[model samples]
Target: EPEVTQTPSHQVTQMGQEVILRCVPISNHLYFYWYRQILGQKVEFLVSFYNNEISEKSEIFDDQFSVERPDGSNFTLKIRSTKLEDSAMYFCASSRTGRTGELFFGEGSRLTVL
Candidate 1:
């Protein structure tokens, strides 16, 4: 049984710093996505990537945010400038298919900005 793995499960950063969350999904899975859940708020989609390009993105993924698959096996989300509002649990997910398929999520990387 394969699962997604995220590094640095917990991260604490200053309000104006930068942060990068990393994820490695199941080897055979294709579509990958980044979603976040602010404390006490509902989970929200941030972005989706496939074939090395962005497939979909939410308004939350603004100029301060970017994503990349630097290596075939790893996917990452970079926050250029963090804010108090950026604190959240960021989840990385992957699915065998695109929209309609079941998505598998990582345990999540918790980001805390002070």
Candidate 2:
């Protein structure tokens, strides 16, 4: 099946440094989103983008997190200033539409703060 791809499966960053996680969403998808899991925690939604702008963003998507679709196929999450709390598995997801839409998620980009 066609799939979304993420890079640098694992990354180690300092308490306050910028980090960018890359993703290539499925070719035909119309909506893109970012979610995170803090080790043993449940998956939490961060943001969703569509048609070149943000459609919806959760409270967790604070000033620290930003997202962009630099190219037709590429979506990225950039953390301007990382924190120890930022350590988690960042998952990139895409869907066609609707509330009941089934999202397809990348394996994940694991971030480690030290």
Candidate 3:
């Protein structure tokens, strides 16, 4: 079975530095997303992409964050300026149809900002 893959299993960055988390979703899935979970909080939705455009995003996904499919296969999330609150496990996910379907998520890229 295919699965989402994320790089830099862990990352440490300065509070004002830029950070990029990468992911490779399942080859045939069309929907891609970025979600995050603070140390002891619930997973929160950040953004969703489809057809090369952002389909939906939450208020938490401010101007500082961005998502793109750089190479048709690799999806990336870029945080222009990392903040202490941005430290969390960023997850990349994809589903065959949409949110209602089973979403395959990567092991997650842990970001730690100081």
Candidate 4:
């Protein structure tokens, strides 16, 4: 079965820097999102995109965060400025539809801001 794929399984960056985490969701799924989870905390929703636009976002998704679906295939999350609090496992997930479909999640990209 097709699955979401993320690059640079682990990334280490300095605080106040920029970081881009990339992902390719399942081809047929439409709704996409980025989620963050600290080592032992519950998952935190960052943003969700559908129909080529942002559907919803959380307060945590501030000016420092942005999402893009540049090529109709690859979806990316760019943190214009990374902070220590940004260190976490960022997961990429998708659903066939925005509401009722089960979400499929990528293994996740680990971002470590020093």
The number of residue pairs in model 1 that clash at the backbone is 0
Candidate 3 residues lying further than 4 Å off, grouped into runs, are none
**Which portions of model 2 show Cα errors greater than 4 Å?**
none
Per-residue accuracy of model 2 over 22-108 as CA lDDT, tens digit each: 999999988999999999999999999999898999999999999999988999999978999999999999998736469999999
The best candidate by lDDT is 1
What TM-score would you give candidate 1 relative to the actual structure? 0.97
The residue-by-residue lDDT of candidate 1 on 20-104, one tens digit each, is 9999988998899999999888999999999999999999999999999999899999999899999999999999888665999
- Across residues 1-114, which tens digit of lDDT does each residue of candidate 3 receive? 788999989999999999999999999999999999998899999999999999999999999999989898999999988999899999999988875658889999999999
Q: Each model's TM-score? A: 0.97, 0.96, 0.97, 0.97
Off by over 4 Å in 4: none
What's each prediction's clash count?
A: 0, 0, 0, 0
Error of 1 at 82 (Å): 0.4
TM-score for predicted model 4 compared with the true structure = 0.97
Itemize residue pairs with steric clashes in candidate 1.
none
